[model samples]
Target: MADKKPDSPSHEPPRGPILVPVDFSAHSEAALLLASDFADGLGCKLAVLHVVHDPQNMPGYYARMAGKKTLTRMADIAGEMLDEFMAKVQKRHPERHALHKAEVLLVKGIPVTRILQVVEKEKASMVVMGSKGATGLRHLLLGSVAEQVLGLAKLPVTIVKEQPKY
Candidate 1:
């Protein structure tokens, strides 16, 4: 038998799917497109995630007063919205056939925490998300989910900024 080269690359399959967080914004569309490209190039799966922050978790006392029925209804609506959003994305980016294989997920919780949890749970190879690029008081008060994910994620994270139409 011929001796094999020690340094030859092994043809191992991709380790995990690429995770994309979509908030159904223009920025998120851009990120989704970028992720589609990555998934196609890497021959890996794609997972699209949308996190709906619970209104009951808001700081205001009134916001925190949501009952179980209200919370359940909200979650159901969010799930429907997520489904519609994914359908739109698929329709809009028909050329990106990799998106057809995407697994869409909807979860309720703090956005950043849920995102990270999904990444770990799914064994994602990388994360792609959009940044609204909020600044000043808004950034300080609301905080940026993309920024938090970038800081906390153990895997590679790509943040795509929305491009102006004009």
Candidate 2:
């Protein structure tokens, strides 16, 4: 019989950078919490990314107007939401002053593509995100960004699932 050796020690990647995609959901808050420890342990910087997918990207005359209005509203909301979220994070963890230097980004584009772009641009060692596990029609028609990123991202991804109790 072959003897089983002890499992190898798991090692976190060298302290580089962490990219966290936040949609201001509770699930995302959980991910950010996990990301905090990861950043602390790895001694890396954490950057929060918020992507605004243009709802109307069509090229027709009316479509152009629709796209403009939609994009503008989305940009406004994104900016406000990011500000609030950043304030909460700062309040939640004041000790991690280093992490406070994190960047809060708001970009408009396809979620997966934009996420990958930021990851590459930041040279992130890992990505932390939330998963709603959207089901049935929504899942079929509009796939979850987390799932898409999981499939396409080259970096390690940690998905935070929402819990019922909290």
Candidate 3:
């Protein structure tokens, strides 16, 4: 009888970019770094997203009081900050060739909702974000965006937490 070859498993390439949401925090920076490495390894693009939470969406009197002009200005400032953040990332990871194809995205909306929207719109293969690891009242009030994303995202989600200081 002729020798038979064993069946080999297929290795499928990643379908879309890796999404990293940043809030200009150190934890977010760590997430960006980790996502960059993953993107390089997977030969996929990296998308750095920053969401400007709309003040108009705030509950109670504040939402009603916020004017359109003020909301516009806030969005503009957020865009500027996002640009600065991207610049810093570029400076820090100048040697990361994969980042050459990275896209910086700034959008206005609730953070978690906008993030999920972008993930679907961008067809992201995975989401990597930082968790502040908030606890107690702060966590209850603000809610954890990473946790929400992890629960809701259809694709893989990676939450990078800051290492504890000695």
* Candidate 3 lDDT tens digits, 56-142: 645332222235445546667667667777788779889887666789898878889999999999999999999988899978887
> What's the candidate order when arranged by decreasing lDDT?
1, 3, 2
lDDT of each: 0.84, 0.80, 0.83
Better-scoring candidate (lDDT), 1 or 2: 1
Scored by lDDT, model 1 comes in at: 0.84
Q: Per TM-score, what order, best first?
A: 1, 3, 2
Which residue runs does candidate 1 get wrong by more than 4 Å? 1-14, 56-72
Q: On lDDT, who's better, 1 or 3? A: 1
TM-score of 2: 0.77
Which segments of candidate 2 are over 4 A away from where they belong?
A: 1-13, 57-73, 97-99, 164-166
Query: Global lDDT for candidate 3?
Result: 0.83
lDDT of candidate 1 over 1-166, digit per residue (tens) = 9787899886765678999998778899889989999999888999999887865654332223234345556666666666877888889888887798899898878899999999999999999999989999978987799999999999999999987787
- Model 1 worst lDDT run, 10 consecutive residues: 59-68
What lDDT does candidate 2 reach at residue 67?
Answer: 54
After superposition on all C-alphas, the RMSD of every candidate to the true structure, in Å, is 4.7, 6.5, 5.2
- Cα displacement (Å) at residue 48, model 1: 0.6
Clash count, predicted structure 1: 0
TM-score for each prediction?
0.80, 0.77, 0.80
lDDT of 1 at 29: 86
Q: Pick the candidate with the highest lDDT.
A: 1
